[model samples]
Target: MLPNGKTNLIALDLGIHGDPIKALERIVQIAKSGVDDHVVARELIALSDGRAETRPVLGMFLGGAGLADSILYCRNQIYPLGLSNGLSHFLTAIAVLVSLLFGIRARFLPPSSNPVRISLIRDGELAGRFSVLIVTTLEKLLLGTRTGESQRGNMKLMAVDQSLSALLRLGWASLFRRMGKTKMQGIHLEQGDTIRIEGDHSSVILDGELFEASEGHPIVLRSTQPVPFLRLAA
Candidate 1:
């Protein structure tokens, strides 16, 4: 039940380690309560549980400690909407490295006739929305480390490189197609920004772990409570 008013504020003690899906369900319930009640869920969020491929890649450009916080801060405050300059350049570097590695790895896989359409939205904006044909979609291929079907069970290290590479190619193609028609957008992450990935049922690799998600059940990513990260003069 929700409190009576134009806005309802509810706090849940989801525990130190809680399930995100359950929390999302609770928020959904509050949203559906009364037409007049406005629900806003606010709290401090930490970085993901463990380290991911992106971590090392980020650490390569930036530093390991507080890496996510650094990326979030930079992307939010410094970078622009398109092409991305300043700190957002890290994302471009990551994308390039990821694409190159994946292209090399792609030769080993079989080709497929049907391609899937994957839409990547950043901060409620279409950054890179594309439909590409390949043996396995980039998202799937990156998350491939999680499944035994990929025959890469012990292959833990290459997740970031492979995933980012495939994603870069896809996003680049999308950018070219969107050029002249609309403003070309690239993937940029920032603090307080929410990334919604809808369509195509699959898992996303974060901090070297697989987060299973499905179509319509989009995964929303946000960062809170900036930590002491990527400090150079330590």
Candidate 2:
């Protein structure tokens, strides 16, 4: 690897899943504006402001090298909700003709999300099962609900058991109408709360990494000490 020293957090929108030139085009526009990096974040963040398209930007902002003695960033970003953004994001990813075909299919062949049993283990006490468990500190968009500033660090869970079709409806609501009013059977975990997920076989995406979640084996989740993350000051 090439030798490195200072901190540089570069976010680009080039990818196979989404438009590769979107971010590059924005970068060129920013260059022509003759502005400094201080204004770059505002311009970049605006691309996703109140819009569906977004990239899962994840990292640990460890200042200095990986030395143990260096100061660490005190922030964590986690989103356990399943994949899928709003309709605008979906529409941008494909040809217009195919988009129409898939849109029709989605209504008739509405998707399904397997039921997952989540148990919150907090402060040596095991809380009962919850049908929905969503944890996030980064993304503002997902599953039709937005977390307030105060709710960022806590994990939200729902004990109200919902039918399979209801879960599907809730998910579709997120995709079609994000800002539109919808309900979430939700509650938050206290700081330092741990959790265990048990259910049929499935997979999970953590920090952009995927792992197999087999049946009969429950996955336990615990929050670690906050690591450093690069956040451009507004």
Candidate 3:
């Protein structure tokens, strides 16, 4: 997608559809009861044809050191997995250790052209690339710069823009100048913001379905009013 459109979404949620008229009646009943916001939302019995920014910006899970996978994180996307997943974890540990000791980020990626912009408009483009670019009215993201923990269900659009969001390691420490949003590598989007990306032969995946972008036909993203969809707890 050029910005965030051309929909082919595949999400797994509870299959519960209720009558809108009855739903309205229940909503009014709930409003009179003055229940919690989450409770009120849960009581809502309708569906919303919502839109999401499906222009998949490389969404990677670094193996969980709180950053991607477990205590050590590959700020860069360095996944030298071994024979088995456990072995992969071991390899990850060794790689991180070696990288820190040698003061070298063992990463090599093609230079990006005119980094993608996640903004409200082309004129107000924000320069940066992110590992996790999330636009939602949910809890804060896990290991995020601001929240530092997984979302507890709140609201906001946050983006962790970077080809490699710095590691608090020896090598990265020496290159402090290269590790920050100040270099136009961060995000906090309000409503009406649009994410624009331009590249040769750009391909976008929406809800797992893929599509290609070409000249005169670009992908686009826009905001949507909150949908009255069912919220099933996991």
**Model 2, residue pairs in steric clash:** 61-228, 61-229, 73-228
lDDT of 1 at 97: 48
Cα lDDT tens digits, model 3, 1-234, are 011211101111222124445544555665676545423121111111113433323221111111122122322233343244445445555554454345454343222222344444533544443333443332222332232222232223344443333333212423443222233323333333344433334343323334343444444443333344332221
| Per-prediction backbone clash count | 6, 3, 20
Cα-based RMSD of the predictions, in order?
19.1, 14.8, 12.3
Using lDDT, rank the candidates from best to worst.
3, 2, 1
> For candidate 2, which ten residues in a row score worst on lDDT?
65-74
TM-score of 2: 0.39
Candidate 1 achieves a global lDDT of: 0.28
Alpha-carbon lDDT, every model: 0.28, 0.32, 0.33
Q: Give the TM-score of candidate 3.
A: 0.37
Would you estimate the TM-scores of all the predictions?
A: 0.28, 0.39, 0.37
**Candidate 2 stretches greater than 4 Å from native:** 1-111, 123-133, 143-145, 150-153, 156-192
Tell me the tens digit of each residue's lDDT in model 1 across 42-94: 22222232224333111100111112222333344435445435335566344
231 in model 1: Cα distance from truth in Å?
3.5
Locate the minimum summed-lDDT window of 10 residues in model 1: 57-66
